[model samples]
Target: MNQPESSKSLFLGGAAKATAASREKYVPRMGEESALEEVLVEDVAPVRISAFVGLLVAISSFTAAVAKPMLVLPVLAIALCLFALRKHDGRTKPVGTLAARIGLVLACLFGSTGFFVHHLKSRTLGNQAVYFARQYLELAARGEESLAIELQKTKPNRQVATMQLNEAYSQDESAMEQLENFRSGAYVDVKKAGLDTEWELDRRPRVFQKYGREKVDTYWRDPSGKFNGVIQVELEWSPAYEGEEADWHVSLFQVERELIVAPSVL
Candidate 1:
């Protein structure tokens, strides 16, 4: 009545296969907990903060490029960064988290630089214009009638020319008041104009004569007595790119109307 050995062995083998199948179908509770921990580590990685900072810097740079009175933007940006850091309790986040801080600094630098450049351009343009005007008077003094006449023919709004010329006189007088010997001139002459006055050459005497979509001004001293000019100046500030540099130009002229024509041009 005892079971055959082969049959017993078969029964044991069947039990073992059933046990393996059950284990495969079941998941360990501890393993599930470990998987969740791994997911959390990935989700809270510092890379998230860095990516955000990169985006902030890009936006800041773009705004800085267009905002007028730009000096204020950088200040505001800096203030915002400090506020954020304070809210975070001064904790050091990822490197990208400091993008705003760096952006603020760069904004300030670029804004200041642009302002100074414009300021210098304005000042130099005004002074040079005055110099050419005064030089016209000097040319008149030396009987260089043709050159002086040519100036009037090469500028915009004769009235503007006269004003700039007077401005030069005022500048010289102001320098005199300061006990400084200053020699300068301003000139205005129509280079090219149309019914609507498409172009002009003002604030000249420090420019050159050239052909383009830009305004140019220059002051030249007629050497070899051919013109008896005092200062040979050429200036072209405005540019013409995609019609953006419409404020740029090239102008050339001679300056000689100086009661105290300094030994040289500064």
Candidate 2:
């Protein structure tokens, strides 16, 4: 009886040891699996060329916003996709790794610069346009139909040259001559109404402001129209403020003008 009892006890002890070992192994395996499941998708994701993409997205959106109402949705979609790409794990890759990084950086730099540049220009043009429009409206209100007609003929639009000639005349005849010789690009500095010192602009038109009114440069090119039509004008303007000294010179307000066409017409 004693021998049988000893054997039973030994067998039971061995089974208990085996069960403990199995439990230990199983616990670690389960824990490892749970840990893997919790790992984030972004943490181990690959790199992508997203900075340039973001810039392009922004540019496209801006252009669409300027050009047509229908372009907004597509532009917005592109922008959203770019935002996602930027947030993705792949962004770092395109910016940091491989020869493609150079192109990506260039694209980012130029694209960003281009977007802001266009925006500034548009805003400038819009403000000028608004100012002109107000003047025209006031004339019309006073029953100065002739002047209003002239304003309409000269106001800026997709055909900016016409607006240039329309707005070219200054009280000073010398100024008019100066304008007729102007050769700058269309650009404007837009700022908060009171903060004229701060330059801001847009690359498109505005109903309340101006659109193609921002001049950068002027050159004559024949439009598809009547042959030998002398009704041509050229214009140029830019937002480049002429500043000198680290902090001594006051902001120069240059409204220079020029006519590339020998016979500029309204």
Candidate 3:
């Protein structure tokens, strides 16, 4: 009976030792797993934040491309994305970098395209303004008074007509006759002293301004290809009746003769 009890006690003691060894190994493994989980949780917040910021940058870039006025927003977004990317590391770095790059490319493309279109439109309008000015000046110089007057925003009033007549008849005895002819609503022949009726444009018209109104300057040359004078015309939008095509009409016309000075022999 004593021998059997000793053997059973030894066996129970060995089983206890094995159980303790297994617990020691399992506890360390559980602790290690918990630490790893804590590390992952700590990393998640930063990655999420970076991704969110990157999404915002992309959206702003797209908006900037569509609406040029919103370019500032995309610039700000790019700055923010860069800052976020700097803070990001490991798995999040690539995502943040990609977002920032995409935003930058889209912003550049849309912004440049918008500016180019705007400049092209301005150039086209300027060309139109210059053409209108040239046509008006051509008609006036050719003594097509009725056709030239049609280009005016409004018909010249009596006061304006009288002033023009006075300027045209400033010198010579025929001035009195021409003034009488103008008052009688007749086309006074001032071809000899007035603008050269046979002049043609010698160079591209210089556009001074293009907005609600436009001003254009053009140089003219006589039949001999000598620069005769400069013509400036101001144009404004004509009144649009319902369903009528939009148009511009001449608001003012001015001509300046080229100065002729004899060379002094030195």
**Top candidate by lDDT:** 3
User: Model 2, range 21-109, lDDT digits (tens) per residue?
Assistant: 66543433224436533333333446444444544444444344354342543444444445444433331333313323343444354
In model 1, the number of clashes is 57
Separately for all candidates shown, the number of backbone clashes (residues 3 or more apart, or on different chains) is 57, 49, 0
lDDT of candidates 1 onward, in order:
0.44, 0.37, 0.54
- Model 1, range 91-203, lDDT digits (tens) per residue? 33533446655655665666566566656655666565555444444554554333343344333322243344444434665424422211223232211111122222222
TM-score of each: 0.32, 0.28, 0.46
Supply candidate 1's per-residue lDDT for 8: 97
How far residue 259's Cα lies from its native spot in candidate 1, in Å, is 32
Once fitted onto the true fold, the runs of candidate 1 whose alpha carbons sit more than 4 angstroms away are 1-86, 89-96, 139-146, 155-266
RMSD of 2: 19.1
Give the lDDT of residue 172 in candidate 1: 63
lDDT of 2 at 170: 50
Residue 7 displacement in candidate 3 (angstroms): 58
The TM-score between candidate 1 and the true structure equals 0.32
